[model samples]
Each structure stands twice: as C-alpha cells, then as structure tokens.
Target: MGRILMKGNEAIGEAAIRAGCLNYFAYPITPQSEVAEYLSRRMPEVGGVFLQGESEVAVGYMIFGAAGCGARVFTTSSSPGISLMSEALSYISGAECPAVFVNIMRGGPGLGGILPSQADYFQATKGGGHGDYRLLVMAPAGVQEAVEMVMKAFPLAEKYRNPVMILGDGLIGQMMEPVEFPDELKSEPSNNDDWATSGMETRKSSRRNLVKSLFLDSEQLEAHNRVLKAKYDRMRREEVRYEPYNLEADYKALIVSYGTMSRVCRTAVDILKVEGFEVGMVRPQTLFPFPEKAIEEAVRRESCKVAVSIEMSMGQMVEDVERSVRGRCPVEWFGKSGGDVPTPEEVIDAVKSFVKELI
Candidate 1:
C-alpha cells in the first residue's frame, strides 16, 4: 500500500482495522473524536463492529465484554474520559483479558482544556483504578509512531493477556502526517480456545473456561496478584524501549523526555550542539516498563553532570527520572502543564541553566 497522508486519529482507526481488531467501542471526546468518527464509517466496510457507547464508562465495559469473548477490542479517549473508564480498566486487568486503549491527552485535573498536556503520565504508568495493576503504556512522538503503536498494541495485549495503552498528546492526534501501514504489523487474531470464554460450542470442547476477577478467598487473591506481578516483571525485562540522541557526544547535561515533548527536546539538543554546548536526550517509547536502564546508563556517562526530565506535565515523569538516575547526578524538571508546550528555545535555556550550575 502507498503512504497515506492522514490525521493521527483517522490513522489510528485504520491501523486498528489493519491489525485485525474487529470490535471497537468508544465515546466521542475532543482531540480524538475523529477516531470514532472515522471508524464509524470504515468499520462497517471492513465487516467489523463500531459502537458509540453512552459514556466513557460504558465504552470501557463494552471493550471488556468484547475482549472476554476472545475478540480483538480497543477504545480511544482523552484524559477525563480515561478517568471515567479506569474502573473498567482495573476489571479488565484483573480478568486478564487482552484489550487496547489509546489516550490522546488533554490538560487535566478537571476539564482543563482541549489542548495537549501530558499530565496523565502518573495515571498511566502508575495505577489509575483501584488495586495494584499496570498498563503496558507506549507514548508516540508523532502520527507515524502513533499508528505503529496502535497496530503493535493488540499483539502485545494478547501476549500478556492485559490491556495496552497508547499515550499521545493532542498535537499527535490532530497533526497530519505521511504513514504507511506495514504488512509486517498485520496479523490474524490468535486462537483463544485455551482461556477465552468464547463458548465451548464454538471451540467444540468440554473444558469450560471461566473468566472472572473475583476472589473472595484472601490467599487465592494474593496468589492471583503474584501471578500478575510476574507478568509485569517479565515485561520490565523484555519490553523497555527508548531513543537516545547526541549520547555519542561528551554531553554535560542529559535531557529525558517522551512523546511530543521529546520532539521539542530533540530540536533543543541539536541547537545546543551547534552552539558548542553538548546536550543529550533519552526519549522513552514505553512509559511503564520505563527505559530505566537506558536513562541510568545515559546519566552515568562520564561527561554528563545532571539529568533533566523535560515533560509537558509539571513533574510527573521527573519522579521516574529521579528513580532511574538513582543519585548518579542531579535530577531536575522543567515544563508547562497548562496546555502550553515548552518550545525548543525554552528547553535549550533550561538545559543551559542546568549546565551552568554544574560548571
């Protein structure tokens, strides 16, 4: 297929279809309503199901229900909508059903604005719903990456039998870019006879599969949680992904960021190099199972004096950055959480200031 110039939201819908995800449930929300709008038309043509639920909460459960039936399912929403769906997310995780979620972030705490913000960092990487559970979160820097992540998310979710999240800011959802849906990413849904509640009649088996999260017995619940923890640990070891820029240079300061902010930081790193101030950046593609080892290595570089977490949120990701750096060097944060993206010049100044303090 030829490269198609597409809005990020539209591309996500198409990508989901291409990934063999036939069931989609969503509630319209800003910066990403286009995804629902696009799929409403496209899904029918593909002989897939498209449903607009009454609310985000309803949409979430719809995804859960479909996934429990061993179907490829997903949903998309912004921050507030995601919060409404968090409870269902917890249930899906507990039941160990494979599902995909895409959050096109908007400024938050309360209907903050329709503009982009990465404030949901803590919500995504940390637990959003009740109980201890984790979502395999991927943050994409551009439309192309977002499309790729959406395609890849389904298989990962199935592999782990857990939900996967694609985290993007409003800019990523609204921007138009050239992208081709790679054939390598296309695949048929895996057989679910082993665990799916799809029905014994369909699989022609006597073994009845029960899918539920309820465990009234304390010991059984603890054992279930331990099993979940093991999967997460395996993910931490196997799924960490990141991109390092200018790490080859003997940089004085290392900047860590992701998603749209990483794109800005990349520009800042380049400009600082031209100005004879060597700076490096590590952009994490996966938020959970974070690129901890990568950042630890970058900050430990001999010439690196400090690690700065540059984000669109106030300082959510900085906490992870500090944990990753583990006191190897000074760790700091600089960002605007009020729907304003920090520009390359602002990032350059922040890096320069950090470097000056080191000198």
Candidate 2:
C-alpha cells in the first residue's frame, strides 16, 4: 500500500488488522480511544471481531481468553486503563499467552490529565503487576514507527508466547503523519495445536489443551518463572534496538531518550551541532532490552565528558542510564512530568549546561 496520511491511533488499528490480528478487546480512554473507534468499524468489514469491554479489567481477560485459544488479540489504552489491566497482564504472562498492548501515556499518579507524559516508563520497563515477569516493551517516536511496531509486535509476541507493549506518549496518538501499511508485515496466525486451547475437534486430536497461570506447587511455579526469565534474558541479548544520532561526531555529552521525547532531543542535538557543540543521542527502540551496550559505548568516547537522560518524566529512565554508564562518566537527568512538554529549545539549553560544564 502507498503512504497515507493517518492519525497515530487509526494507524495502529489498521496495522493490527493488516498483521492478521482479528480479535480486539478494549475500553475507551483519552488519547487512545480513537484506536477502538477506528477498529470498531474496520474490524467488521474485515470479518474480524471488535468488542468494547465494560471496563479495562474485562478487556484484559478478554485478551487472555482469545490468546489462550491461539488467536491474535490486542488492545489499546492509556495510563489508568492499563493499570486496571495489570493483573490480567500478569496472568497472561504467567500462562505464557501471546498478546499485544498499546499504551498511549498521559500525565498522572492518579486520574492525572489527558495530556502527554512518559511517567509510565518505570511501570512498563520494570514490572507493573505482581510477580517477576517482564513485558517486551517497544517505544515509538512517531506515527510511522508506531504503525511499524504495532505490526511487528504480533510476531514477536508469538515468538516467545508472551505479551508485548508499544509505549507511546499522547502526542504520538493525537498527531497525524503519512504511513504505509507494509505487505511484508502482514502475518498469519500461529499454529497452536501444541499449546493453544484451540478446539480439539478442529485439530482432530483427543488431547486436551489446558491453559492456566495458577501453579499450586512451589517447584512448578519456580520452574515456570525460570523459563520466563530465560526468555527475558534472550530479549536483552537479541532484541536490544536503538538509533544513534550525532555520535559520528566527537561529542562532549551523550543524551539517552526515547519515544516522543527523543524527537525533541534529536532536534536539540542538531541545533547544538549548528552552535558548534557536538552532542550525541541514543534513541532506544525497545524499552525492556534497553540499549545498555550502546549507552556504554557512547559514554566511553574520550570526547564525551557526561551522559544525560532527557525524558518526559521527571527522572525515571535515569536509573537505567546510570546502570548502563556504570560510572564511566557522570549521568544526569532533565525533564518535566506534567502536561507541558519540554521544547527543543529547552532541551538545547539543558544540553548546553551539560556540555559547557566540561569546557
């Protein structure tokens, strides 16, 4: 398909349909409700199912049910809505079900506001629900990236039999950009005769397929957790993705950022370059398998005197940045958590402070 101008939310819905995900369960929430709105009409035309659950909690279980049956299922929600679905996410993860979730974040500790925010970085990269499970998290900087990640998320979920999350801020959802629905990204559903509770008659087998997260035996549960941890470790080694900017130049400060916030930092890098200050940026594409090695490499540059984590939240991702740096150089953070997004000029100023301190 040719590139079409589309809102980020609608593009996500279209990308999922193109990826052969026929089941969608979600409840309306600010900034991301358009995903449900778009799919509600589109799914029926595609011979797919789109159901709006009474609440996000219900939607979470709905996803778990379809996934256990070996169906490609997905949902979209904002902060609080995703919080409601956290328990179900843990359940689905524990049961080893493949599902997709899109979180278009908005500001908040509570009801917050319907504005862009990256405060959920911890909730996403760390663990939101109980237990020791991790979600394979991808952060997109724009609408096209969002569409691409949505399409790719399905196959990745099936690859590990785990849930995947596309983490984007509110701006990514509300903005419009040209995007192409790639034919190559369209995927067929996985053959789940081995694990999925797909009907026995359909598979022409008498063996019963049972799916449940509950493990009464301590050893069994610990064994299951070990298997899950192995998958996460593999992700760290194989799925670490990032884009480096201005690193080719001898930079004095390295900036680590992601999602919509990275775009701002990228602009800051360019402007600083024009002002005769070489700054580097590492934009993480995958949040879970964060580009730790990339950050370490960037900071080791003799020209680089300091590393700064620029984010939408006050200072959440800085912790990970610190771990990656490992005291190779000083690590600092600059951000705002409220609705007011930090402008490119503000980022430039912040980078200038870090760069000038060394000189």
Candidate 3:
C-alpha cells in the first residue's frame, strides 16, 4: 500500500480496521475522540459496528460484551475517562478476553489539564485496575509507532487473550506521520457465532461457551491468578522490547527513557557525542513487559556506570530503571509532570550532570 499522511488518532482507527478489529465501542475524550469519530465513519463501510455507549462506564462494558463473544473489539480514551473504565478493564483482563485500548495520555490526578503528559505510566503498565492483571501496554513515541503497534496489538491481544493498550501522549495522538496500511491485512473472525450469542439458532452444539471473570471461591481465584502469573512470567522473557543507540562506544553514563521523551533523549545523545561524553539510551517499546534485561545489559557495559531514567512524568519509569540496575549502578531521574515535555537541551543538561557526578 502507499504511504498515507495521517494524524495519529486517524491512523489508529484505520490501523484497527486494517488489523481486523470490527467491533468498536467508545466514549469521546480529548486527544483521542478523533479515534472514535474516525471509526464511526470507517467501521460502517467495512460492515463493522461502531457504538457510542451511554458513558465511559457503559463503553467499557460494551467492550466486554464484544470481546466475550470472541470478536475483535477496541476502545480509546484519555486519562480521566480511562480511570473510569479501569474497573471494567480489570474485569476484561480477568475474563481473559481479547481486546484493544488506546490511551492518549493527558495530565491527571483528577480532571487534570490535557496538553501532553505521561502521567498515566503507572496506571497503564502497573495495572491500575483492582486486580493482579497487566494489560500489554505499547508506548508509541512517534506516529509510525502509533500505527504499527495498533496493528501488532490485535494479534498480541488474541494470542494472550488479554487487553492490549496503545499508549500515546497528546502529541503523538494529534500529530501527523506517513503511515502505510499493509496490503496483506485480513478481516476479523466471523465464526465467533460459534461462541458468541448472536441468536443464530438451529445450531447443533450443546456445549455452551460462557466467558466470565468472576471467580468467587478463594482457592479457585488463587489458582486463576497463578495461571495468569505464569503467562506474565513467560511474557517477561519473550516480550521485552527496546531500542538502544550509541551502544558500542565507551560510555560514562546511559539514559533510559521511552515514548516522546526517548525521542528527545536520542537527540541529547547526538549533541553530547558532538562534544566528548560517551552516552547511550534504551527506549522501551513495550512498557508492561519492561526491557529489564536490556537495561541490565546496558548497565553492565564497560563504558557505562551511572544510568538516568527520564520520562514525561516524575520518576515513574525510574522505578523500573532502579529495579534493572539492582544497586549495581546509580540510577537517577529527571522529568516534568502535568502537560510538560522537556527539550533535547534539557535532557543533555541532565545527562551532563550525571557524567560530571561520575567524574
């Protein structure tokens, strides 16, 4: 297919359709309403369904309804709305239903101002929902990542039978980028009537497929948790995705970051290299299954000593950085929460300070 100049939100909607997600349920929210609006137009053309639910709460349940039927489903929102949907998200994860979610992050604790921020890092990765389940969260730093991850999210969610999230800040959601919709895309499964209650009678099968997350018995719930934990354990080993740069040289320090902040960190590495400091960066693509081993390897590099974790939020990713180091190297943090993004120069300043401290 030809490259299309697309806004991030529109790209996400098209990508979802291309990836075979046919059922979409959403409540419009800033920096991401475009996603829902786009789907409302596109899904109908594909003979798919786009439903505007009564509220965010109902929208989440709508996702549950579609996903429980073994259909490809999706929803999107910003910070506050995501929080409102978290309870249902937990239910979907516990039920082990395949679904996709997009969070165009904005500032937050309450109705925090929406410009661009990664304040929902912990919520997305650490599972803010009230249970021991993790959504596969993909952080897209650029518009291309937005589309690609949205495509990848479908298979990943189905394979895991868990909700997958494409987490982007406002800039990535609102910005434009060249995107190529793959020529080899396939339509979603229609045989979900095999399990879905679409009211097609005269079916011969007596075995009914009931999908529910409710496990009231304590022993059974514990066993269910253990099984999910095993899946997550496997994911930690198999899905630790990251991009490293300037890694071959002798480095006095390394910077760890992700999403938009990682893009700036890359620029900082370039500028620092122009002078004298040997620095590198590790940008995590999958935030839930953190690139811990990658971080460890970079920390163990001969040229590296101190590592700094930078983010658009204050010290959220720093937690992972510290865990990766395991006290072997000094891990530091520099970030601005609440709708602020640091420039390359600011990152360079932080990196230089770390180098100076090491010297």
State every prediction's TM-score relative to the real structure: 0.99, 0.98, 0.95
lDDT of 1 at 334: 93
Superposed Cα deviation of residue 336, candidate 3 (Å): 0.9
User: What is the C-alpha local distance difference test score of candidate 2?
Assistant: 0.94
The number of clashing residue pairs in each candidate reads 0, 0, 1
Q: Write the per-residue lDDT of candidate 3 for residues 224-337, one digit (tens) a residue.
A: 999889878888887778898898878888899888888989988988888977788889999989998888988898778799999988789899899988888899999987
Q: Whose TM-score is higher: candidate 1's or candidate 2's? A: 1
RMSD, candidate 3, Å: 1.9
Candidate 2: minimum summed lDDT over ten consecutive residues — where? Answer: 350-359
- Poorest 10 consecutive residues by lDDT, candidate 3: 193-202
Which one wins on TM-score? 1
Superposed on all Cα atoms, the candidates' RMSDs to the truth, in angstroms, are 0.7, 0.9, 1.9
- Model 1 alpha-carbon miss at residue 302, Å: 1.4
Q: If candidate 2 were superposed on the true structure by all CA atoms, what would the RMSD be?
A: 0.9
After superposition, candidate 1 runs with Cα above 4 Å error? none
Model 2 residue 90 CA deviation (Å) reads: 0.4
Error of 1 at 42 (Å): 0.4
Model 2 residue 130 lDDT score: 91
